[model samples]
Target: MIYAVGDIHGYADQLDRALALIEADGGPDAEIVFLGDFVDRGPDSKGVLDRLVRGQAESRNWRFVLGNHDRMFLRFVTEGQQHDDRIKSGLSWMNPRLGGTTTLRSYGVGGPDSPAFQPPRGKVVETLVSWWTNQGNLSDQEVIIAAREAVPDAHLNFLATLPLWHETDDLLFVHAGIRPGIPLEEQEEDDLIWIRDGWLEDDRDHGKLVVHGHTALDTPEHHGNRVNLDGGAGYGNRLVPAAFDAGEVFTLWPEGRRPLVPA
Candidate 1:
């Protein structure tokens, strides 16, 4: 059986709970797919990344699709700038408004009084160092430095190799929803990463169940033959995970938030 989940958005605790439920229902034999947005807008983005990286390394059946946030992470790593021309042109002020600013701050990237003053490149290195030393579990400082220096090329290669989309027998996964009118081959990455209302409203078939996360819906809303599992997890909203074959759904809310029915 296959189990698909939506945007984790750095909620490692919630993710753990959801995965526990999945395991209780079915063991490691079950195939699991995550719809991306694995980082940002939470206190533990580093932890989330570590978990996913470990999972991918160890598991053959697990799949992870690229999200807009993940793309931003790559851009930040390569371009050394938070705002990409393509992203900004596509949606003005959308990236920064959606807790991107906060996420950058968490990485020690942008602030008025930040030490990243003269050379922004220094800031990138500092951010990486901070993430490595503080967030990573390297026992020795020298080991961490050696690891960073040795794996520079590997890191870039891995980020660049992330798949923008993934298709399976039961579901089609993307960061955001796809364009309704255009063929999948002709669809733009921006639309797949940023579209909301139109794709959700259109009823056209996309050959398989299009499971996506990007639109921060209040609930696990379903429309246009697609399942939107974003659930606004990063914006103090509930973390929702939808399982495909088992027909199960799990919602992990903040301390006082109201709960949704399981499955």
Candidate 2:
């Protein structure tokens, strides 16, 4: 059996519980597919990433899909690009609406709002940039440099290499839903990681059973068309790790496995 986990959103404690449930219930032969959004919003973004990285390395069963938040993290530390409109050149994912600030804090890099977020001037002024571009992307050198410096080289490397999707003969796993009516092979990157417009509204088939987590829901929903495992774990809700086999789906709750029905 293969287990598909929902969006973790930086809740490392919850992610651990969910994993414990999976290990106890699914056992030695089970493989895992993580639906992404493993960072941001909630507490312990670094912890969440650290755990997943270690888990994946120790066990060969783990698979991961890229989420938009994960992309933002990569952009700040790896690509040095701020794609959000709220972002200025060197803000380092400063916009809190997507919980970038929280994620930054977890890595020991305070947000722009924090007094220590950036120093007016110092040794670290330019030692950590993409090329050590002490030339902060922002007019304010101090603020732009901490986010990159605070994160470790290993974590940045891990974020830079996450896969966009994972597929099996019976199931297709991704961070977000797929575009309806379009073949999976031809779907665009934006649609795979960010599209929600017609992808969620349309009831048309997506060729394969796509298991995803991006659109948050209070409970995990199985729509027959697709399975949504996002339970808003970053927003004080449960972090779900679901088990899928044959044509059935079940969430690994504290009490044990419970059936998850189609939406």
Candidate 3:
């Protein structure tokens, strides 16, 4: 059996439980695929990622697809000051409003920054950092610089290596939905990781059954052509992990399985 888990969003406890549920449901040999956003907006982004890094080292069957937040996190850490608005944004990843503060806290970074500290509104991350410093929020600015150092080397490498999507004979697993009508192989990376635009509205088949997260729902949604398994875990609720037997879907747990539509 193949199992694909939805956005984990840094809740290590839920992640552990979800893994246990998968193990109980499919035993040791099941192929596990994780759709990302594995960091930000939760208590333990580092803890959640550390577990995945270890899982990858131990199991060749484990696969991961990067999410938008994960992309932002990577840019914040690795890309440094180089900013193109096309690929980078204005320190949104470091702002608490976008859940970056919670993610940084997981790594033992980001102290009590000034409540009033706001970077100059700009399109470049370099400008944001510079503005923070200019505003005399020196402590917050220094923490931003050092937080990248706080991330473990293994964790950084793991995040850097995550794929945009994973595909099987009949299913395309991605962090977010693919753009409708576009050839799957030719779809833009941004659309795969961040799209909600017309992709969510159009019901036209995109060749393969797209299984995804990013757009959260109260429950796993079966929209015929797609399955949305993001249970809003980042917003603090159950982490919805799912299993697919051939192409049928199920919500999995230790006690039992709830067959999701057409199963």
Best by TM-score: 3
In TM-score terms, candidate 3 sits at 0.87
Tens-digit per-residue lDDT, 138-184, candidate 2: 33245346766778877877777888899998899998878787777
Residue clash pairs of candidate 3: none
- Cα deviation of 178, candidate 2, in Å: 1.3
Predicted model with the maximum lDDT: 3
Across 112-183, the per-residue lDDT of candidate 3 in tens digits comes to 451233445552353334223232454544655676678888988898899899998888899999888778
lDDT measured at residue 239 in model 3 versus the true structure, 0 to 100: 90
Model 3 error, position 242 (Å): 0.7
Worst 10 residues of 3 by lDDT: 126-135
Residue-by-residue lDDT tens digits, candidate 1, 88-153: 334211133444434444444444221211224533211222222233333223323333343245
TM-score of each: 0.70, 0.84, 0.87
Candidate order by lDDT, highest to lowest? 3, 2, 1
